[model samples]
Target: MNKALPVILICLLLFQCDSGKDGLPANSQLLRNTDISLSPDSFSPWVPVTNDGFSLGISQETFLSGNRSLFIENQDSLNVNAALWRQTYDGPMPSEGRRLTLRAHLKGENIELKSTGSNIYISVRMFPVEDSEGTTINRFLSSQNRFRIFGTFDWEPLAVSIPSFPKDVEFITVYLVMGPRTTGKVFFDDITLTVE
Candidate 1:
């Protein structure tokens, strides 16, 4: 029996090592996920906001200087009042991946609750190639539903995690959205994605 124990221990250690490679605990209930921000500069190939109905700019001098900030111009009207920043990637993500945690620093000015709501928001989503405009492969986060509030030009780090899909997803897309129907300006910097 003592000899058998050694073999069993080796098997368990191997299993744990394999699981760790995918950034998951050995007994984790969720599927494996990886943080995208681990490689900061890899988030290239972004879509810039150009619709006349909306305005967009880089949120901060530091982020703008680093060339990593995305800003939305809020055009408040009875019918139309929102701005969006979006990007898509064609590479394969861990299909069995279950959740994404979006991390970023945010700031704002004249942040009226009525104009932009009481909070700032950010989100990440995954999409399949064949899906329609309204269809989403998976929703990692939504600012309207999940966000943090700050009223000054201070750097506040925020994070939100969503579990809607399994890890088997291929072709992922991410978006950072701010505002419900407000006109206040907000800044975002150091956007990151982590999977676990």
Candidate 2:
């Protein structure tokens, strides 16, 4: 009976350790409330823009090798625009109590003069998909588009704080929008999200 008691106690201890409720375990590091980092070689899975005339491409001359690559497109016509690519996953995010910080490193070159305006902004959005329209209720959590120049390759890092959202958030989307009324080229790379 004494030996059996010792074995049972050990089993109970192991069970508690294996249950990850205390905090994140070694293998669970990636399962946090932050967006994955984007390197030159690694990109967050992006949903292609299906809007009329918008397109996406890969740029090599402008990215940091092995861990950085640029997503580029031409918003030359009034109807065409550029957007952040999106991807869907079944993984879990951090619980709703924590605040999320989004970060990105980007550079723009050959931006035409006519593209200057508040419409040319970079934004991050979170949306919940519903059964009715096949479209999600989009919440524009944050954005940045105020620039002083065009045609210069400016390397910039942007960070935005996202408040705790409702539990219904089904998808998070990031975008680089050229005002639907303007025309030019846009480039982006290196995005990160952290929980605080």
Top lDDT model: 1
Candidate 1 Cα outliers beyond 4 Å, as residue runs:
1-44, 59-68, 75-79, 95-99, 113-119, 129-140, 148-150, 163-168
- Once model 1 is optimally superposed onto the true structure by TM-score, how far is the C-alpha of residue 167 displaced, in angstroms? 4.5
> What is candidate 1's local distance difference test score?
0.53
lDDT of 1 by residue, 9-60 (tens): 9999999888765644223322111222223545334455444455675433
TM-score of the candidate numbered 2? 0.59
- Residue 54, model 2: Cα distance from true site in angstroms: 4.7
Residue 100 of model 2, lDDT score: 57
Please provide, for model 2 over 48-98, each residue's C-alpha lDDT reduced to its tens digit, 9 standing for 90 to 100. Answer: 554555556556566543433445455555653445454443355545545
Most TM-score-accurate candidate:
1
